[model samples]
Target: MPVITVKLAKGRTVEQKQQFVEVVTNEAVKKLNVKEEWVTVIFDEYERENWASSGELHSLKFGEGFGMKGIEK
Candidate 1:
């Protein structure tokens, strides 16, 4: 079995998540030789204030709307 964990800033639609899961599951099944049922995909979403990079919080660097529509940098 293959377990995949994806972590990202919050604010995505269900359709986006479903599309990602489908693509990831297909790749896992093909590359890892795992059954579709045995492949697990997990998403861990966080707020901009809770995530940071380069010793700076994303909220401070990009405001509270980072990763939202029209604000992905």
Candidate 2:
């Protein structure tokens, strides 16, 4: 089985996650030669405060409620 773990800031709709998983699973099947059922996709969500870059927390840099919708730079 192929296990894929994706870590990101939290707050996304279920539909978005589903679509992402579907696409990732399909790609894994094609690229890794793995069966769809054998490909595992795991989403690891974190709070903005829990993620940081360049010595600043995402929550501090982007302010609160950041990444509460979609991907943010």
Candidate 3:
């Protein structure tokens, strides 16, 4: 069995998370040789205020760095 946990800021749509889970689970199944039924993926969504980068609160300072740029594409 393989267990994977991913943490990200909340607000993604259901479709986005579904795609994420599908891609990750498939990769795990292929790389780890785990059965699809034995692979588990958990997404933990946090508020922007609860997450940070570059020592600044993510909600307040995320746009100034590569954060917003990465998401734009």
Candidate 4:
């Protein structure tokens, strides 16, 4: 069995998460040679304040409502 963990700042919609899971699971099933039922996908969501990069907190760097929308290009 393959256990995949995805960590990201919170605020992604259910649809987005579902889409991500479907794609990731399919990839895992093919690349890892694991059955769909045996593949496990987990999400570890965190607040913007708790997540930091470049020595700056996302909340301060991106500001409010950053979440998934903030990282979009």
Best by lDDT: 4
lDDT of each: 0.84, 0.83, 0.76, 0.85
lDDT of 1 at 50: 93
> Residue by residue across 35-57, what tens digits does model 3's lDDT show?
99998888888877787778977
Q: Which stretches in model 4 have alpha-carbon errors above 4 Å?
A: 67-73
**Candidate 1 similarity to native, TM-score:** 0.87
- Say which prediction, candidate 1 or candidate 4, comes out ahead on lDDT: 4
Whose lDDT is higher: candidate 2's or candidate 4's?
A: 4
Q: Give the CA lDDT, 0 to 100, for residue 52 in model 1.
A: 84
Q: Candidate 4, after superposition: displacement of residue 70 in Å? A: 4.8
Q: How well does each candidate superpose onto the true structure, as a TM-score?
A: 0.87, 0.86, 0.79, 0.85
lDDT tens digits, residues 1-73, model 4? 7888999877789999999999999998888888999988899988888988999988887776645566664
Give the alpha carbon lDDT tens digit for every residue of 1-73 in model 2.
8999989877777998999999999999998898998988899988888988999888777875645433364
Displacement of residue 47 (Cα, Å) in model 1 is 0.4
Q: Give the Å error, residue 6, model 2.
A: 0.8
Decide which is better by TM-score, 1 or 4: 1
How many clashing pairs per prediction, in order?
0, 0, 0, 0
lDDT of 2: 0.83
Q: In model 4, state the lDDT of residue 29.
A: 85
What residue pairs clash in candidate 1, if any at all? none
